[model samples]
Target: MRFDQQFLEDIRNRVSLSDVVGRRVTWDRRKSQPGKGDFWACCPFHSEKSPSFHVDERRNRYKCFGCGESGDHFKFLMETEGLSFPEAVEELASSAGISLPAPDPQAAFKAAKRNSLTDICEMAVRYFQQVLQSPAGRSAQEYVQRRGLSAETLSEFQFGFAPPGRDNLKTALLAKDVTEAELVEVGLLIKPEDGRPSYDRFRNRLMIPIHDERGRAVAFGGRTMDPDGQPKYLNSPETPIFHKGTMLFNVHRARKPAFDAGQAIVVEGYMDAIALSQVGIKGTVASLGTAFTEDQILRLWKFSDEPVICFDGDVAGISAAHRAVDRILPALTSGKSFQFAFLPDGQDPDDVINAGGVSAMYAEIERALPLSEVVWQRETSQARIDTPERKAALEKAVEDLVGTIKDERIQKRYRMDLRLKLSNLFYEESRRNRGPAQKGGGGGGWRNNKQGGDEDRASTARMEAPDTPAYGVERSFCTMCLMFPELFERHFERISQLTYSNELHSMFMTALVRIATDLAEGTVTQIYNKLDERFYKILQEAIVSSRPDEDSSKASTLQRWDTLTNRLQILKEDPPEDFVEHLFLNYADMLELRMLEMELEHETRAMEENLTEESWSRFQALKQDLTRRREDCLRDEQELAERGTKMKLNKAAMRG
Candidate 1:
């Protein structure tokens, strides 16, 4: 008796393969892929050491490399328990809490039709595989080889080729009693609207058979070998057995590997997925040349909570990622969501692998943005929010996007985070627009003036504002940016606009800009290699200047960066919400003050030389400006010292 398709699907979803298979198999954790829902063991049919059998819980399929047997739970039960197909179904249904309907005539017919379609798909796959080895497939063979695919990898994936001859596949399938109508129905042959004869849909292309979760071929993805090919890649047209939007390319193959690594990566195309797999980064799948649908995203979550959506790092690629995020946001659950990976500009997985190998590609993967960060960046990156009206619009846009989230707790949290981000942005902007004195510059009062010569007073003035020690202040800021390159991502433009006070400051700032640009493009090594020895010495000085006792060789980048952040946090009373910008403004103030002091020194010299009216006027103006600037600088220093002392006392009280 045959069960309904819906009933079978229910059972499949309810009962996990690992739960059922684990009851019978002795699972070896060491043999299994870490976190990939893989249960590895010796083949149950024939006992042997060193497990070659793998049961992938994510896909609900099991395969035995030793015995050449593979299938879903139903097939496994029938073979292992020596039960009939109906008995196996009944057993699984009972365990899965599914009630099967009594067999009907229509059910039997539908089941038979489904079996025939499955058979046809398998037959076509075999035929294509055979043709791949034939003399006519030399170009196809070369294509795979040129892509660095070994013979083993080719056979493992069942790679194939279709010849240029229009009637080749049609004639071969028809000879095997696969009717022309069946070929058309399966999307192997194209039927014409005009009076022209039907011909092959995929000609002179590399054929990759796409399999269902049960490891049965359902459709094909074909790639053209021709350089001038119109559509570089093509997939089987939507047929009875295959739904394009619902399916992930190479998902069947990637499921176990993805589960093992605790990561599932979705690439832009089939070749990108394959290229990653070849380099030991397994469990990578590709979208079928379409924006990821809700179903596809959910399907990916079965293997991992945060599947990385890796696309090219170009404008079009970024746009595709934003579109994917929009599609995925509504379906996001508490523990499940999508991460985005952008390959270097104009580079795909193959390009990255060619340039720097698997580790470099993995580093890029590590940089994949979280869903929240992606959302925040997408809404903010496109436009500037300088005015109150524009800022309100930005806030409303964020609210609308977050409104789409169905989870109330997640929605509330997202709203709070976004509000805080907006607050930070505007608060920093306000600080920037305010006058220099009010912008946290100087704190010392003019009432406590000391008598001294012009140069003596200038020297005394430098000692009063010790927080920004002139010799090391520029180096310290540059060090923080170098150690935490993410700082550069947000402040690169501001830093570029800064005027340095000395040659050392200028050179350090230039190197910082170069490194930031390279870091953004995922090409840091290239730029770092081109730097001169003097640059290294500058870097070393920056590191040592920040922490006099810090072992520059042993300090981790993150440790140094954290130290910088901590230093900034304690440097003021109620620190600016945006600390990076605060540091930048401080640097700008320092540069401006230095220029004013230089002018004062020049005027003093000119006054001593001539004592003319113009010199006297300029000298008075210069001295007045310098005195005001020195007081402002001193005030800032006192405020910072007070904040630092209060913080230290608070920490002491806490310890007490």
Candidate 2:
């Protein structure tokens, strides 16, 4: 369904854009605009040397000068993180405390079908929970007890038991008025080729309800209590709501703590996540009975830049770590890091936590190796570098890995370090292989090949480098002004219309137009009061960037005021018919009158304090000028109102 623009704007008004962006980025406040109150951060949208991203709180919009990218909160989320429009809208709406409109009837119908399925799954979980308390579930209960799972852990993970009989779940769901179609859709009940009624898909097994991040139970994984079972563990097939690859078991409980801790511990199984949490390592997530996917890595990256992969220290565990390293390396750069931790042989996180304690687990985590070490070991170990061909192959592998890095400085550093290590290993290996006849050469063909590979790897690394730009302090100040409009308006006349590129100039001009319109409508205060968090951040950033100081002398202020009045007259010469244009003109005239009144008040106060003839004369002149300008402004306003009314009448007559 298409979300209306007004609804989107309402959501934007409630949610802070800075808060949302700040969750994923570190915002640096520029020193020059600290008092003005603006935030500056490197642009997340693109690579840049300095922060050119401007967020105008007064206007409730953000624009990046480097990329010419501008948008409201929803657009920012959609573009910055590559989320779907609906997803972006939903995220903002949740942040803004706004309820989404009901889906279309057609969409609602489909949603209801899914809800029906979810209801059946809920019934199944309840049924299994009840079964676990029954005599028939004695074996399942025994299995849990043997695993040393506490009652609290079991309940939190929704651990349950499927009854021994095949038709137990079917009868239970049917009793709850769940339709046969929904039971099949939820993957709890299976339909046979004979077109008969549903039967339990899982029987005589210990049940674990798999929940998504929202805590909605979408599927189940069942482990056999009896050794005679064909498959040791059975899981729900891919259904309407459950995709094994994307779902992370226990993420609903782990996400917040992980975000707060600035790290996430990824385990290999549901029990591992449950066990880790039971032992006080609460920030733990597990794959849903499958291997990790790139999508899962990306999702985890949203929460924390550092993710620790805790796997078994067996051959399979090593293999899994290698695979994870391969999947995660391309996404790794300056801001993010990954690590791999291998448990003692044949031990998973659950076994270690249960055997030693939480400290043991922490020790393991502390000893985790960096991703670079893992990659280097994995690549170098597999290659036979005794021959020139093998050395060339190893060099090529290193190049491929280095090429995956997006940051030039990081790539260069890693390449040099790896080359030195490889060179040392090659020299040692060559020395061992040398014979009496090869004394002069010392190292064999491998040593020469390694030397050549190291040079080539270093040369290949230099091919891709980053471009740098010269950042200007004035441009940064202008960005600050764009972010803080209240301060801009306070010193509007004093600000010089500095020369800038078309893009930066247009962004600043739009902000000025918005501020003028808001002031004219007598809604400037209301605008900030009602602004969304995102826009408020933009405003704060602008204010902080502009560095508006209040120290204007009476004479200089009045001269600037005259210049602004003249400019406003020109701006209003051919005002458009739109409400915004009329508002700007009105605000410009009011600003001029306000300045004149301030001057008159200052001069009058000075004359009273000094009681000098010259001061009295200056006060009289200022007062007269203020009175005449006020009258002239009032007349101009009246004329504009009359003209507007006449135009409206003319349009109405033409329509009639």
Candidate 3:
């Protein structure tokens, strides 16, 4: 029995592929990232010493390098177990909590009719292509040429044209024995409400065929050739095979390249997709000119976990990105998310490419902003949090949006990220910017002021008031972000998510990120000047400036030197660039373990309050994660030390 594609999709989306695979194999903890839905285990079909079987739960598919065996959830069951295809489907459906549809004769009939309509669409596509090649499509050909689309591109994308007549396509299709109702049903011909004959739906436009995964022409997206066209671009009405929200243009063409590249590019227009494809950027697809949908986001995840959304840098494009962020937040999984690549003011991908070539377009991609940063920026861009109530409102606005995330792990991470940012923001707003104060005979740096008032106490509580055991690590990451923002751009998403234990350090981060994203260079001096006086002490602690008046005998002086020596080892002359990144990540790992410990404390309390199986499992998972991170931290530190020693020895050899 054939199943509905959507029904199968529903089952696939709801059922966890890793959970099924986990029952059969022990995941290699070192290689498997459960949070990312990516797992590695030895191939079950072929015996292997090392893990060669890989699973991408986001895509609900698995592949084994050992035996070249690959498939989705149902495929895995059919191959692993002795189950038939139908049996596997039923099992997965049952697990997904979906009721199987009763067998119906009409279902086959409807499916056949739907396919017939798709064939009719193919015929219409050929008809449009024929007219474009002939003398009648001169204007459309001119438009194509002017857009810099080559003949190869035109043929590859099946670029076509419709003449300026309502009945032109209808008459041609009807002559081939296509029924008027069938033509109207497939969205090729529009049926007039009045007592008039059906006419063509697309006219005087450059027609681009929209295909499905099977490479069948299911719909048409038309760009108007007329200069004063009202809508500018028109698409087919929702037909049996064409649903705008779930369909992306060039999916059949882009999927392989996107999967191969391990990334995908989402553009706002098909013309942009075609242009990029022409320029060798094959992993690009265009969204239907509709509001971004959750279904579309999920579908994109099949191709790439963090697909880049390249929208125009104009007002409308920015608006679309914001709307996509709103639609994407709820559907964000642990590993699956989106990034935004905004072009120069009023520029799209095509414009950038035309002016500076493909490299310019890539430069835009390199600077794409993470979804979290986008949300953080949108909330804080025009925000004024001078008063406590305003700060609460700011927190509420961001928290309400983040709370919409369905995944518990991702939601918690977002919550921590927000608290860190807001801590910086709130502390800056409420801090009394005092000048250099006499603390321990001015030998020590800024002393911790005794914060009072309910608001101040609440701020401290939300920010995790006390310094963590990994305070040194937190300061290192914060310092790196401020001092070397460019070197760590690749790790910006992870660094930005780190919850800085110190409020002033968090504030420095918030400012640094804000400036960096605004197309300005992020410098410690810029942040220092822009921030309140409280950040001065934090900055001094991070970069390690000379304080001649400091007494060496003092504990605070000793503490400052200790922090500088232990964490900021880069100061011991030049290290390998890669080593610096690894050191940065090492610091990140320690801080993550610190945050996990805090989570462990909370989960322990909740488990005590309610001794349920799920709570117990969650608590254990946290404990396991904390343990694993500690191991990773140690491993990283050893590697950094070895590499650092090697670098120092090499430098000494050069000097000799």
Candidate 4:
């Protein structure tokens, strides 16, 4: 009966949310925009004349402003018809013409055991609540008062206490016909190896029930009253019904509020969660343990768009936050990521509230940093970047980390943002250390000169030779442009990339690009007049390798280049549009191939320098892309030749 998210989304995407909800309520014409996939209707859960129920087809979710009811297609059907989760999914799938996956017997058996264990845990919850209200719970009552917890919070969270004994919970549950093995299975009792008898896991401690998303009690967290307790905090051991890594405390209660506020807060423990919730910050949950797993991170996304991990600003908190970045990177997509908030040193959620009340805690939340900033800080905060080798190492480390991101668009963005920061950092350091002689020099190689500089050269060098092997490709791209200067108008983006193997070709292209763009209706003589003496002087030497047998005399060098362009025009008589596209694709693909090969080679060297899973995966991805693009390049040429042959045959028949 368990369905993955993809299957649910598949059904949701196929059916219109409004069509489903329309069956229950009439649409409000004054506020609805059917074309935009936004609709407003009256509350289906409660009676209201004014429409507060909204269905947004773009998000495929409906929200009720009156009753505070919100959910998706399946949730709507389940709530309206009083159907179970599986029945609702089956209804949606049948309507959407989608088939459900076959049921798994193993999964069904596991679900049955989990449901049974949950029942026992519920029984334990009742026992704890009873003892909490009895005379034996007087100590627990005083402790809640000392912590500034109100009567409402104590009753709302079902706060309880475990008596100081080996068989307090066991004896109570056994009298209810709960077997000893069932108690042990749900982590309520601890079985010893010495054949001594199983006892209660939590003793003389404050108890908080851990609930699943559906608000089913599955486990418990206990905090000790003794100041010198060996472990100040303890959580339930893993059971069929409870998984520490997969569940977050207070998530069930926080989900709706988090959705309304468009944010979620994460603390370390359930105590922090209670403190924040008591202070009216209800859109908060706590990671069950020290480790934040992939499943928990995704669950946070379900409640809020950008969930913030609020931790203390001390060393331990910052270190823990840094470790979380790696776990989040591989799963990052376009807009999905975590923000981090650090409380002041020597402060927890309780301390923050005590010192400044709720507004002060809100201020801390306002200062939360984005996940990208955390990545930058984690990389540059501790490393030494005073030397080129160190700088290269830093860049390589960041590249490897960014490469772990599965989304190509997000990975490219991280590269751009971090590289800009790196440039500024290095530039400031250079300015501070630069002597009087180096002041006139500008920083223009990679960043200011179109984002290709020392970093590209260092990170993507060929393994075979010290010099780049992409020179021939760069030379051809330049020659084609010098012949067909009109190419500047059409393929501006690729030309501007200037990802060249040689500096002189890149410089020449930059100069030509400026003349083509900056000048208004540039004529041949106007272009010649605009060229500086030094630039005109090296135009021949820069292009000498393109034509070695030609004379290098300064007299007719410019004339010789013009002559070659005319000759190419006469010899190439294909259709203009096809010819131009072919030329652009050929040049662009060659440049890309050369650059990618060098990057692949350099990645091998980088792996040898520091072998890691991220680097190895990146290298393999580059190789795959290179193979795919190489085939695409050949396909382009073949398609072009077929078009050319068809053109020739059609013209011949027309003449006949």
Report the lDDT tens digits of candidate 4 across residue range 1-656. 78999999999999999999998789999999999999998776654547888999999999998667899998887655434588779888999999988769997787778888999988888888888889988888788888899889887788888988899999999998989999998999999999998999999888889998767899998888777875777889998888888888987788767765567899988889899999999989998875789988877776665789999889998888988999999888644778888888879989999988888888788667778767877887676767877877887788789889998766755654455445544553454367654331122221122232222221211112214566555655665664343454457777777577766666767776675554434323334444443333233322222221212253233333322233233212334443555756676887878779889999999999999999999999999999998898788768766766766676456334
**Candidate 1 wrongly placed segments (more than 4 Å):** 1-103, 435-656
RMSD of 1: 20.9
Q: List runs of model 4 lying over 4 Å from the truth.
A: 2-72, 75-109, 435-656
TM-score of decoy 2:
0.58
lDDT of each: 0.69, 0.63, 0.73, 0.72
lDDT (C-alpha) at residue 541 in model 4: 28
- Candidate 4, residue 493: the lDDT equals 77
Error of 1 at 511 (Å): 40
What does candidate 1's lDDT look like per residue over 362-476, in tens digits?
8787667667767876876654566867767777788789889987756655654455345434443444467543242111111121232122222211211223346456655
* TM-score for each predicted model, relative to the true structure: 0.57, 0.58, 0.62, 0.58
* Total colliding residue pairs, candidate 1: 13
Model 3 pairs in collision:
none
lDDT, residue 575, model 4: 43
The residue-by-residue lDDT of candidate 3 on 339-361, one tens digit each, is 88877788878889999888778
